[model samples]
Target: MPLYYYYFGVLNATLLFRTARWRPPLLSRHAARGCGHAPSYGKMAARALVQYVVLRGDLRREPLSWPLGALVAQACHAALAVTHAHYQHPDTAAYLDQGGSMRTVVLEAPDESALTTLAETLQQNSIDHKMWIEQPENIATCIVLRPYPKEEVHHHLKKFKLLK
Candidate 1:
């Protein structure tokens, strides 16, 4: 290809390498840096998922819910986690408990059939939910139910773009 394009590629690669090696400024002990973007509902939701996944280990094995005053980002995280469709595996039932006071649930499944079963079960429980698809280890889905009101999400989403 053109020499200019080759040099540009090399420069871009070098910058990425340097940034990856650089340390970010630490926030207060109580505050953590987010994904480096404005607090949109989608971004918040993404954060919640990462936190939930990291904290809970397995979404399928846990039933999660948040109080009304919980951070929207946390809600979004749980929402994104369940809707992702990976938490539907039958193995997930071990972590589920009927008496949990969750306003929402995150279901993850590894396959379409399992996801379908999960959706049906949630519907049967009279629980409100949403669906998300994720590729973790394998193609899977996570369904997040009883999400924060759509109004909250719409408000945040309006300020953000889904595509860069």
Candidate 2:
């Protein structure tokens, strides 16, 4: 003969039984509360993981007529500089940890004035960024914001459109 006790609600009402060759199975209280069911972010990570790259659209317009590739290179430069500058940041690490799937939104500003104005707005809001100045030319051609959760900075960038 064996004695067995059971509880309902895992912790409340109780019942006792005595039966030969019968036993209560072991169970953990914490396990029943879904302790091991936290959401897993493997492969497809969470959203809002992006960096914003803004380049002057005028480079490809008017008499300047810079090559399309040249403008792309400027954006790349800013992206590299900003990422390097903030490599130790948690958001930056998460962004890069995405490996080949790293995300960046390339936006276009109409001209240097537009770029400068956006820079001012970002500065006013205390957002960290790098305004890339090309050497010899000494021009503010592109800007890159440190990797951030999109929701944190999207409003400031929403007015701009994709570079291409």
Error of 1 at 54 (Å): 14
Best by lDDT: 2
Give Cα distance to truth, residue 49, candidate 2, Å.
Answer: 0.8
* C-alpha lDDT score of every prediction, in listed order: 0.35, 0.75
Candidate 2 lDDT, 5-101, residue by residue in tens: 3356342212332334322221132234444422223523655577899999988887889898888888888888888888766676556655456
Expressed as tens digits, the lDDT of each residue in 1-164 for candidate 1 is: 32222354433233442454422222111124332322333443433321121111133232433233332343465555554443332212211211122233222233346555655765775544554433353423344453343443333223222211
Each candidate: how many clashes? 30, 0
Once fitted onto the true fold, the runs of candidate 2 whose alpha carbons sit more than 4 angstroms away are 1-44
TM-scores, all models, native as reference: 0.24, 0.71
